[model samples]
Target: MRNLLMKVNYDGTCYDGFQTQPKGNTIQDRLEQAILHLTGETTKITASGRTDAGVHAYGQPFNFTTSSQIPLERWCLALNARLPQDIVVTEAREVPLSFHSRRGAKRKTYRYTINGNRFPDPFQRRWQHHHPVQLDIPAMQQGLTHLIGTHDFTSFASRRSTKTSHVRTIFEAHMEIDRSMCRPSSTDQGVIYTYVTGSGFLQHMVRIIMGTLIHVGEGKLQADEVAEILAACDRAAAGPTAMSQGLALMSVEYEESWE
Candidate 1:
């Protein structure tokens, strides 16, 4: 059997989520069905992690062991042909049989986009969280700094998470204004982008952090209060969980190639 690693990008607006559910369509379901059609094998694929419903991905990596003799270079093309328009296999390569996408990942990066415009852009409605109220970018940036380093992220993690540990190390966290997508009519404002890279993330951790930061941006929470919230380790002590549409899995990283 050969283990293949593939990168996928998808628009999650129409699917339930990354993982398969009993009633709704998912990214994994579509990929498995495509593999079944192309390889004639009911192979199960493992991903680096799952993205919640309405959350998109720019670089989601997964691994599957198969007996098919398809050329490595052609795997992306084959899978793309069978997958839906919203999901595309961007790349594929051979990997060691021992490599598991989720277990082998060293870190992952996620990006959350916010539309700070007075009026929502029709094209960005599906991807960005539209917040009409002007945000204090400096305050949000300060709040993000507190998220760096290892700590109990219980304040930000979702109650639905089944993980035993709420402690995770955030390698980097910051936000920036994206002016390239700004409208001519809008002044002193641009799209806001929040980026976080971490060893691992609990369910809805990033979104919750975004929510807290948004609270800081709007003057509801002080920038320094983020540290207090982290120490509290109480979910209720944090701000609301931001909308899912704004979050996207940017990339998964490993120390070295498994090839």
Candidate 2:
């Protein structure tokens, strides 16, 4: 059995999500079908994590076992040839049979984009969450500091998660504006990104965290209030769930230490 690991990047605008569904229009379904077409092999692909519907991915890793003799370098090209334009296999490599995409993951970094501008950009409407008012950046940054260490992120995850442990170590968390430009008549604001890296995240964790930070920015909650929210372990105490389109699985890390 030849084990292959792939780096996948997708727009995630039109599909249900990364996981396979009965309807067969997801990222996994498209990848599997493309692989089958390229190598005539049927195999299951496992991702580092599942992004919610309309959530994008930059360097999501997935693995599968195949007996096909395709060259590793050509796998990306071959798979992309059969897949939709929105989904692309960025890189492919041979890995040990012992490696599992999800199991081998040490940490994952997520990025959530917010359009903090007065006017919405039609071109970026599907890629970011548009907020029409100026946000209190300092308040949101103060809130992010509370999440940098280990804690039970119960308040941030979906209540539907039945996991035995809600505790995850957050290696880093921060929010910053990517870029800002002033024009003669208008401003060209790029976007604000909330970045979080952790050992693992429960379902909807990052999105909920973003929501809470947005609330902090809006002055609805203070920065220190995040600590209380985590301690409460009550999902209802958290802020609203942010839009899925603003969230992206930026990358999966397998290094021993992210610190």
Candidate 3:
């Protein structure tokens, strides 16, 4: 069997998430169904990682084993033809037999967009979180710094997550203002992004981080108080988990690539 690696992009507004679920439509289900329709093979596709429902992806990657003789160059075109409009296989290529998408990933970057206008932007309503207030940018930036290094991120994860270890390394964490602001005759300057690159993330980690940072901006939480939360390692110690729509999986990095 030939192993195929693919780069995928999806608008997560209409799906349940990346993994296959018995009840909800998902990215994996779509890809596997498409592959089965084309090759008559019930291929089990593996992804670099999972993204929660309503979370978008710009460069998500996955791999699947197939015995089809179809040229790798045409895989993307062929798959895109069968997949829904929200899900697209942007690139595909052959890879070594042992390459595992999730296990082999070195780092992943996530981006969360916040709309700071007094009114929500209709255009960005489905994608960006509407804050409707000036978030203290400097204070938010300071909060992010507290999470930049390696630490147990239990406090920033969902209470229901069952991971064995909560320790994760954050290589970089920062935020930037989006001056181009979303439409809405409001502040016309309420778009900002919080980006976090890490080896891996726990459930709701990024959203929780974003929310915690926002709390700092609102003066609800002191910037330095984040350190205490991290050390606490309790889910209740962190801020609210931000809405999933505002979060997007930006990119996944692997130690080596077939390309």
Q: Which candidate wins on TM-score?
A: 1
Cα lDDT tens digits for candidate 2, 1-259: 8889889899999989989988757999999999889988887899988888999999899999999988788899888899999998888888888888898899899999998766777888888999866678888999889888889989998989999999999999887786653244555454898889899999999999989998998999999999899889999989999999999998898754211
Ranking by TM-score: 1, 3, 2
- Once fitted onto the true fold, the runs of candidate 2 whose alpha carbons sit more than 4 angstroms away are 181-190, 256-259
Report how far residue 158 has shifted in candidate 3, in Å. Answer: 1.3
Model 1: ten consecutive residues of lowest lDDT: 180-189
lDDT of each: 0.92, 0.87, 0.89
Model 1 alpha-carbon drift over 4 Å, by segment: 183-188
Residue 92, model 3: lDDT of: 87
Better of 2 and 3 by TM-score: 3
For lDDT, the strongest prediction is: 1
lDDT (Cα, tens digit) per residue for candidate 1, span 1-259? 9999999999999989999889979999999999999999998899999999999999799999999999898889899999999999988988889989999999999999998877777988999999979798999999899989999999999988789999999999888887776768765367898999999999999999999999999999999999999999999999999999999999999878642
What number of clashing residue pairs does each candidate have, in the order they appear? Answer: 0, 0, 1
Residue 83 error, candidate 3, Å: 1.0
